[model samples]
Target: MTDTAVAAPTVREVVAALDARYPRSWAEQWDRVGPVLGDFDLPVETVLCVVDCVPETVEEAVAAGAGLIVAHHPLLLKGVSSVAPDTYKGRIVHRLIKADVALYVAHTNADVASPGVSDALAARLDLVMLRPLVPAAAGSPAEGEGRGAGRVGELAAPMRLADLATFAAGRLPATAAGVRAAGDPDRLIRTLAVCGGAGDSFLRDATAVGADAYLCADLRHHPASEHLAAGGPALLDVAHWASERPWLDEVAGWLRAQFGVTALVSDLDTDPWTVHAVSSNKENHL
Candidate 1:
């Protein structure tokens, strides 16, 4: 008699498990979640996790031999009028389909989950006893009735703002841009608030919580200026993509341990802008 071993969970099954854990419906109304492509029946040999679904990240997924890519940000958030190759996002969509690579996003749902994006970020910075910063509004799941967003925590030892920034840049993926801060470099900080991406909206929460500093991404000029002027917490702005990249590793590790399937973390720097700055020495040399 020929023996035919039963197959384990396919890509679709794994995706379904993820969806059950973090329901797509729980995501913010504008978010684009769920599978982007590929057949559910196809066996998933390997998976890749990333922060963004940009062309570079897709390329990395292809190179990693990933059958599926689980990303933090949605590849298609808004309704697309067309899929012509002219547009950047369009081209990315085209490339993924051509490569037979599947995409799944867990945006705000993952953000609000316990031990989620914000929690991971806080852990990276060695923060302790983390709790919700904004403490999601009453009746919202994000209030930690089951989930929450934006974690606030205390540092094991308070450090100056500049020192904390240096620590963060070292712990996170090294980027040409490194880290940037807007506050008194010498200000000692203990209580800190962190949000994974585009966290300007939580400034008030951070201030109200009495956090000595707030770590997040996509801090606009006017808001940051106004917050500081209002005696708000010191702000440390990082690449939106970079700040959330650490969670990819955490997620990949979890999936690998949970399902026993090989998982890879995409190391693509999907941030659109590249840093180009001249040092004083370089200027003198020039």
Candidate 2:
């Protein structure tokens, strides 16, 4: 039997479908998410999913003929007076506008969505029987066990902290930052927790949840050091971009399934720190 070609949805329709899953209302008050730039009426024949909507990813989207870019991070989180072509963010805006590609972001709302960012990360790590690391408020719209900032769960079997770190690095997309860990590497760990991006803010929550180890990104020195000194969970820090990139595939698949658009995930390395130089004699310095 021959199959019929599915028509792609309009940009408005695609944005609506995405908002249905990761509602704008669920986002924090300070967050600037949802559709940023584009003509809603334009038919979206292709979508590009990316962790960050930087120049490289923007070029990739244009090259791939994507009419819409679905990004995890907001391109303009703070209010801006203008989008002049001279500035960086302005250049991105001008580029997307010139290319007729719409831009949409799904920041914190996507984080707290069930089967969302952290959930996707957990799945990649093979975490089982997951629950929210920080549960949403009691009457929040997101109902169920795993709706929150991050996810906490168990490994299929206990392994040394070092082994778990290796497992995570293997599963995650490789980046210049690579993975760094705190706490005793040899410590046995089974219960695990994960937050897909910049999760240092959740260190207390991870400890409170009794996670033996927490896998996250962009953990700063003071917070990590104090947390470990206070007997908190082991920390496995990854690249912010790498930590969130896994969701691109899942989100792209959803876009394809829901709207029949040809969705592609951009594998371009957009993480700001692209190089690392280590000292001799194995004395490391970031």
Per-model clash counts, in order, read 0, 0
Which regions in candidate 1 have their CA more than 4 angstroms from the true location?
A: 1-8, 85-87, 143-146, 278-286
Candidate 2 lDDT score relative to the true structure: 0.92
How high is the lDDT of residue 193 in model 1?
92
Candidate 2 Cα outliers beyond 4 Å, as residue runs: 1-4, 143-145, 281-286
Candidate 2 residues 1-286, lDDT tens each? Answer: 8788766789999999889999998898899899999999999999999999999999999999999999999999998898999999999999999999999999999999988999899999999999999998888776565688899999999999988888888999988888888989899999999999989999999999999999999999999999999999999999999889999989999988888779999998888889977756866669
lDDT string for model 1 (28-123, tens) is 878778887777887777898988888777888888777788988887888889879999888988888787788888999888877688888888
User: Which candidate leads in lDDT?
Assistant: 2
Per-prediction TM-score, please?
Answer: 0.90, 0.95
lDDT of 2 at 46: 92
Q: Cα lDDT of all candidates, in order? A: 0.84, 0.92
